[model samples]
Target: MNIAYLPIDERPCNTDYVRRIADSSAEVKLFLPPQEALGYKKLPADKEMIWKWITDVASEVEAIILSIDMLIYGGLLPSRIHYLRNTEATLWIERLRSLRKEHPGLLIYASNLIMRTPKYSSSDEEPDYYEEWGEHIFLRAYLQNKKQREHLKKDEELQLQNLIDTIPKKYIDDYEERRAFNSTINTSMLKLVKEGTLTFLAIPQDDSSEYGYTSIDQAKVMKGIEALRLHQHVQMYPGADEVGATLLARVYTQLKGKRPRIYPIWSSTLGPQLIPMYEDRPYQESLKAHIFAAGCQLAETATEADIILAYNTPGRVMQESWDQSDKDITYTSFRHLLTFVDQIKQFLNQGKQVIVADCAYANGGDKELITLLDEERLLDRLLSYKGWNTNCNSLGTTLCQGVLGLQGNKQKIIENIIYHIIDDYIYQAEVRMKMVEDFLPLHNLTYFNLKDKVALVNKERNKRVRDAYQLLIRHSFETITRLDVQTFAPWNRMFECGLILKCEQSEVSKKC
Candidate 1:
């Protein structure tokens, strides 16, 4: 019941979100490293401090979930930019071996990221050279890898040649050298899993695509898994921030000796077959992988299920959340939002726990879906709900919460749902871009950097979030008599913000 967790980074998604999910369970007591030891954005954590924290807590905890990215490279972003050689990386691997040797009975679960190569040019989370050649570097690898899988068109081949000729050789060398090293470490991790040093391992691909460096790296890791016969022991899927929470769900479910059965109902029939943004496979494929990875199973029927996942997805074409206002024709013609809501109601009336995965659009929630759920007054009754970032991100987090909510504290569960509605819906879907465009320009600020105006930005963001929540959530759920919201711009960027929620319901006060 006592588990020590080291997150992928200090981001709220990695740190605060896991804590909130764990708090939902009455049986779980989770301990995390001090905030200062986790480090800031782009700056690596103090590995020695984190190692000391892990060693100090090892004796008291029955289980420990670690982010190898944090342990070996200090943090997630740091993993992408680190200059570590194999000798140094191997030293950290040995450290893990020593920990396993020290605690022979410890139930260890670990997660490592397959470094992502973003298609766009931005150094916000990458090296300085990425500011110029990020897109080119990504394309070069993508084309090169694609050529091996299948023949490229003449135009594509010409473009690849041009890219190779234009980009400076040194940048490609720097980028690939780090990738080769990270891939080597990934292989070493499999050896640990094979030797029984780790009870389970998750290698999540961050910002992946079908043909690229990530796919190439995934092939190598998969080969290792096959060679070591770790199919039951390891899971490699498309995810990043949500892996920590997924592992926690696995630990909780396994400890309780309960494998929760989930039945998924999609809004659009074609939704599951079609892939969502920033992922490499179909939504259903990733959903199945995530279900098993979280220590749960798929139910053939709703009656036999512990939780019902009402997955709201696009009809035919998937788009970003911000573009929903423009409206896609397929979304209306191919999908039935009204029918999806009705099914959710039927399940609830049947006395089944229902959770909503509002992944109709990427990067945020679907307004139409949330509106339907709200009109039916189903917001406060669901076990869990999420719609944010990539489809897998939302799916993985919602699934984990759904599993935990089976026996979790009711107040905590309700508070967590409201927290996501405020965050995933009100802020991400509605307020973030509006604030960035209308509010930030008045102060002469940029979306990527708030500079000295972080407080000013937070003040405006918190007010807007509260106002949106009042309109969208509080009006429908009267049990929420009062709600106070405070938000922080972690890394001083508008892309993602951390929120603190204090709720006073008719029954109890839940601070999330």
Candidate 2:
């Protein structure tokens, strides 16, 4: 299959991840735009150049998976900060229409984010005024929506009115006007899906909450989807950054005309019902939505499954990845790690392909889960292992890798396993916080801005990752003579990093 993927941004998770998984299969030929053309943070990509590139390859590729934010608004951050008028934005819809007209047979899978309203005051990814009034803006909308939906106490009413009166009207006006514009654009995309300009559409909610601007907008979009009766053609879920890979998986499955059955096994008895952070729905509900979105089915029995998704979720309580060192007692008392690993071993013994979704903590992998897998020498044996950013991000990418791994070469699949361990586990869960705590202070650096000291920070990062690899993985996998892992701070921040892995490999007939 020939696929052209336009990522959400130049992030490694979006670009390199899809490429590595696609490379696992010789049958899949994937094409991506030049990284320089994709632009930097808050900078719009060269849309004309990207459009030309896509048109040039449209005739040859079987499918084109696109990030509508990138194609129209330049990138995800640009989408949030863009000054494009509604009329100007609508022109991009026409561009999509033209693309469809030019290539009627091309399958178009696209994703657009419903702009997020962070609960905290941080202008790092939002507007400058957000540094002062971001929380106020989120609360204004949240309180107003809550008041309308349910009764509010007198104190709550006073707080809402106080926020309305205290915040600068201009700031609120600007933020809301842009949201209205983005919402219109979302409706326009749905219209495209209905008209057959797009084959599949995913509207992923980023940093979504139970109630607020995001959920309210979701209700509006849900009404739009129902009005158009496009449920079968559209999927709305809690995810960002991972939607591209999810759609790519869908395209791969549709091209092969196979809906692989997946059987899910959870770490805790109550894990499936508990909602992870930054999302509104329960973990298992989101899992079902993702499975259906990926062109895969939920297996009723392990005997009939093609993939065993060993999902590692939270116990009675959930916390950030960095807090795993002092994790809640419920993690041990409520969830049994021994039973989880034992089930994974049983599945492997039964000759089933297994994929691990290490979602016990948000923003990194679960150390306890990774340690158990590593001790059992099952790290490189799984089809995929992902725990990064948000719960949905990990779930979506893991599913994509699992689907592609079915036809992947053993070497490529093993390489992906090592890649995730280094990035998701070694870097995100452990080293990132260590640098912020230990290394950053030595250079007078903050987590948000590494400044000119990025190289110094990354130098320390690479060393720590290499050491962790030696400690956690090298002993079990002796086939890897030397593993040189380099980490890059793409946004010059500690929240995420890009990894370049170099491995010296020897031939092995069996799984490590």
Candidate 3:
């Protein structure tokens, strides 16, 4: 299985993982187009140059993994050079269609642009239509239309909500519109797969950030993948550096028939507030208690935690107050975390598996955090800490890569990672029970079906679970193991003993 991977940019974790996986494969090549190079402030304006670069790379490989964002647009950075509509996916689709006509046996797996809320503001730094006259013109048109309405009041504020809502929500969510404007760029690649123009089509899971929204129902998109029968033997993971690594490793190993060395990098902060914005009263209260309990456990048994999830809370005054003249102590805490990164890198360099998930709660602080830690010579000690604003997406990617190296088959690897995830949940519950004794009964009494158990467990834990699970998952990736009695004995015995004792007391009271 000859493989070729084209990462969107250098900072992308997917490329890094793919590189590692390629090391274990017989024939795996990496092709990062010059226009899509990392840290390139702007892509080339010449459309022919871009097309030539993409075609040149695609021409060499039997299978290609292309980032739709990089291929159609330039990068996720909201800049004129990174614009997608102008560069266009239609050309790429045509090129791939031509390729399929030439070599129908070739495989192409491409990721679609799943809408995500854009964090970095291109308008803030660049003079664009949206900045110069787009908002103003829209506002003026809205006001003029309002004034012409005889029954309308003139006091209405010229707000974005009032103007943008004019465009119907259903229209925006329309499948045809999504495919045409965004999904088509990626789906067209898959069309090649369906028509036997390509062999395997892997569509990456896109987050809300791609659509310029805070959140999205990824399940809906996933349902579409299922409906199209694209889920069968298809390798799909959350598109992050680590996930790409894992998927590539699994695919490569399967093709090469050998185990590969796996290395994981973890970086993140934990001090961020539990509640960013309040939505539900009950949920907020529960979250606060859970965070406090988790914090107390972290501070007390920091060593027990595989990875520390830390972040600076928003509101500079509050952050300052939290620091409270303990700069040295705070610095020392971060240093200790960096020490773990260094150690993990050492293990990886020694040809052992290493996983790194750096948590950044308040966005855009990872660079400063990395700088501070590097001042202590910690960054040099690790293999990679390549991005800013680390999140769950990166963590999941790393786990996928690590698990992939350990497991040969893609679906089996996913199942194994999930199984370890279950064990991780039980471990955390045990920790929580130890920290807050009152919750022990609740934890023990909760009963979920197999499917519900997996879902519920996944929901409760954050990135830390990913870290710990990866450690154990590396051990069980290839083997089929049943849940031993030991996994449930502790909680089950506690519940059973409690129930029996209560029943005996009730009988004695009745006899008395």
Candidate 4:
């Protein structure tokens, strides 16, 4: 299968992950736009230019994974120059339709943008015009438009509701308008799916608030996709690593039939903290209990283990730290990870099985750091790693695609993906329990007297625990099963052959 991936330019995480996945499949051919053309300051002038480039290159490939966001926006919203860039989705739909006409047999899959609202802050500039205008109009009108309603004060809440009500009926009441906007892009891709020009459409499940829309039901989304008779896989994630890892683990268990011991090695405390944040209480606690129960046996300092799950969870520990001055201190953590890689190499030399499951953040300025690491022998020593490129960081999207490949049926793939998400939720519960256990002892209290404090703590802890659990759960479940195998199948087969040859060489050495 000749697979061509068109990712957003200069997205290191996405590029790295896709590369890892592609590496798994020797038959896969990756087609990424030049990195110099992918950032906010240096994006391509015309969307047509990028699309034309893809059209010219993709004509030769049998299967193509086209990221609409890349061809249109270049990257994520933060990297985009303006809100107008968001409107480029229309152009993409038009171009994709044209492509369908030209290459009807090519398997085309497109990823849609699901907006997610960032945490609100007074100081932060509102990125969306709809959000800013909605807030402004609502506040101004709510205070003056007394004839329509009364008893509502001019606070943020009243203003918000008033704004929601006054949002031009064309924008708010018109579900068709909203659906049309979505379908403008999705419909074109769906056409390809219907005509068997595209194999599937992968849509990332984003928070409703991001699009200034109400929350959508997972079932509803899946049902809509099924009506089209196209395979749909929901990208399930809590955040990044914790969720990513757990999801990969679950998939691996289902596919491989054996649960590999998951050794989570972190360079800092932030990596450890991620576990309780995202996953559900039962699964989180169970995993912790299992790891601790296995004790030293499961936790090997040496890299000779079957799998080396390494993550610098607090990718920017200093950025996350309370003190900005300490940012330099965080660099040590990454260096330490590199040191660990050296140790793993020694173990490989000793003929031990090893797989490095990497989840780390590379900042905007850290491109050279990553390049240097990749150039060093450290990168090749691992059996596999994620988030090394822009594509890989999109664990949710990659996993969803992989699920489609494994199940082959759209509905069943959606069901299994849902089941996997629920499983992560269960694990999240376990993590919450463990947090309670750890915090309770520190407070010298039990659950009996913990009413008021528990309420406050739970409120804050819930978000944290949810995030951590999701990061590990998602990454683990997705990587082990979907991304890794799809990306590395041929490489692994070749590696196994090389391993046999090495063993024979060792036997000869012994005899000599």
Candidate 5:
């Protein structure tokens, strides 16, 4: 089977992840555009080039998983910053209509992001002037939505107006107009889904909040979906990047006509209550949504489940791993992390497929968990694992990969598992993050954005980091998998990497 996939960006989670997950599940081919055509933090992808690529090759594939946002605005970030009139936006959107007309029977699945109103003062992911007024803009959106949803007292109303008045009218006007355009384009997408132009649509909330302009925009999108009776095909949730994985899992499950059952085991009592970073809801709610989105059922008991989701939730508060539970920061205890490893070991002994969501702390792997798991030689035993981005991203991605690992060639599956372990766990949660903090600065760069002389610096810095990663990752994987797999960051950002694993166990040199 051949599947044409258009990722939101060139990030690991959106691009190679789709390839790795699909490769593990079935013997299928995924066609992706050249890396240059997909956008990055502030770089808009070459949309016209990608459209041409898809047009030329899409006829051969059985299905396509596209990012509707990417098709129209180059990527999720570009979607928010792009200045386009309705007519100009419609010209690009109508390309999908043309696609449907061309491929009448092809299954088309796509996802769009609900623009996030960043709460920070940094313009890393926003427009330039946002660095000055981004936080204020976010507060205004939050207070406005909160005020409209419930009510503000006379004093509170006065405060809200005062806050709005402080923000430059130009900034507020640009932000509002951009959001209104995004919201309008999204609803127009629904009309396509309603007409069967799209087989499935997933609208993931990007960096959502409880009370913000995105929340209000979400309500408007939901109303349109309901009005068209497209709830059966459209899924609105609080997430991004994970959408591609979820949609791919859905396609895999539907093709097999089998819905596996997943049972979640939380190491901490407050697991469900704690809301991880960049999300609006608690962990359990997002897990359930992701499970359903992946075409899987939730089992009440582990005994009835085909896969087990083991989360390293915090005991008191979820602290960043780098913080080491210091200075009032929340963290899971050493004893609890040890106990959690024992639980996963028990599952492996019980002959059950276990996928570890190692979010004992967010943004990286639980150091103690990885250390102890390595000492016990249990990393290779698990079905899958994830702990890189927000809690929602880690949990959903691990679930999707685990669900897909249920089938496929055994040796091939093992290779795929090792790949995921390397990328999602070791590289993301451990090495790459440290490199971002320590190594990148030598070239005057930070993880969030590039400093002066981006083009030349990015190239030299990526080489330096990638070379160091190849060395460090070699040692890490040796302790776990005992395989010296060749790894390279194709995009030169250390965010997404390509691995060429050779099967030494087989008589022929096997490519995995």
Candidate 6:
């Protein structure tokens, strides 16, 4: 089936991830807009060009994956900064209405983000005032929301009120006003979904904490969805970036009429409850939501499961290489790491289809686990492996690929295997860590803005990443037919990459 996708921004997580997973499916043929027209952290997307492309392709594709933020506000960053009047802002709904009129039966899957107030001061994605006052505002919101949830004593109430008052009323007002505006837009989109315009709608909480604006907005959104009383047509979850891929998986499941059963195995039993940064709930809740979003079922036992998802999570708190550099590596004596690999080996030996979600850390893959897999010749033997960006991002990608692999699509399986090797093992495990130490400090400068330094970084990223692929290709030249690539860090840092490509081959290629 032909699918047209509109990403939230040009970030690799947003742009390349969903398209890659969708195209890897034998049942899907995906089309996307030109990368030049999309927005970055500070820049806005070419709205006119994107809107035209959407209209041109809406009729040709079997389904359309739309990011309402991209359509209404050039991009996610632009959504935060754009100054649009009421009528002008609602024009996107009007645009969608027109599309519905044009194609009476087009399947539309759309997503909206519940606005996130960052904890730290970073002007990279927020307004200029955020650099200094961002933390202060976030604190005020936290205390204020907390006060409402729990009964604060006289002293605590006054302290919270005093803190809120210390914030410049204008700064606080501006922040509140933006949230109000987005809340309005989100409510309008809810109405559209209720009126039969959207086939499926996902409103993901972007970034979250226990007490914050996310909590406040979620309460209000839950009420709105309840009022509309729509079941199986809409949802609100704890991830923004993973929603696109999750929705595409939903579409593919609908097309194929299959709901695969998956059994999840974690390195640490607490891994499922461990909530990483930027998310509100535990990892377990998010896992269930992604599975439900994809129209799949979760199995209670591996024996009854169609697929096995072995998730490598950190024991206590997930840490990145930069933070855990002083920590010792895991050896076979480490029960968590050792037992995890052992279970995976047993599952493989049992003839079970296994997909590894290597999220032992947040930003990159777990080196200890990768080393074990390589030593065991299991690196390229699994159905798939993903260890990039956030845990949910890795989880959803591997989840979809695993479920779809049940269809016995040899082509999709081969392409997915290549992606797993290149992304999870080669880049996340090896090149990424090396490059950071070698190039993290650029031009004798620390904390440099990427706008001035992206070209240099991307140029080097392309060489190192592409060369890794080429090296692997040469090793398995007979099995590999061809390869294509455009790798870069859209966020201007090396936390993740926007790797968009396609590899056509009959046999699965895997080697260390």
- TM-scores for all predictions: 0.98, 0.98, 0.44, 0.43, 0.86, 0.87
Ranking by TM-score: 1, 2, 6, 5, 3, 4
Q: Assess each prediction's global lDDT (C-alpha) against the native.
A: 0.91, 0.90, 0.37, 0.39, 0.75, 0.75
Q: Judged by lDDT against the true structure, how good is candidate 4?
A: 0.39
Top candidate on lDDT is 1
Error of 3 at 335 (Å): 15
Angstrom error at residue 227, model 1? 0.6
What are the C-alpha RMSDs, in order, of all predicted structures?
Answer: 1.7, 1.5, 21.3, 18.0, 4.1, 3.7
Off by over 4 Å in 4: 16-28, 35-45, 72-75, 78-94, 121-184, 206-214, 217-220, 229-381, 385-512
Sort by lDDT, best first.
1, 2, 6, 5, 4, 3
Off by over 4 Å in 3: 1-3, 9-29, 34-47, 50-62, 74-91, 119-180, 186-190, 196-220, 232-251, 257-352, 360-387, 396-512
Candidate 1 lDDT at 368 equals: 87
Worst 10 residues of 5 by lDDT: 473-482
Kindly report the root-mean-square deviation of model 4 from the true structure over all alpha carbons: 18.0
lDDT of 4 by residue, 335-427 (tens): 465555555555557754443322333211122222333445443334433332111232333332342223233232322322222212221
lDDT (Cα, tens digit) per residue for candidate 1, span 333-431: 999999999999999988899988888998899988888888898877799998989888888899989988888898788888888888897888889
Worst 10 residues of 1 by lDDT: 503-512
Model 5, span 1-512: residue lDDT tens: 67788988777668767777777765567788998788665678888998998888779987788898888888877887888788878787788899999999888888888888989887766888889989889988888998889987898788789878899999889999999998988898899899999888888998899898889999999999889998778888888878888888777777668899999888777777778767788888887888888889999998999998888776666666455426123354422666777888888899999888877665656656666776676765777767766777777678777877776555555565566555555555556656677767777766654445455544444454345434433222332223555555544454544555454335343222
- What digit string (tens of lDDT, one per residue) describes model 3 on residues 1-512? 55666564444234433554344333455555563343342333333555576567665766566555555555433222233452456676776678667655555555444433222222332324334343443343334444544324545553544655664444333322433455444445545655665555444433222121212324444555566676543333333223344334344444555433322222323333232211111212322222221111122332433333222232211121112223334434543545544555445455443333333321112323434443443332222222212233333443334433343333323332233233222232222233224433344433212222433333333233334334433322232332221122211222110000001112111211
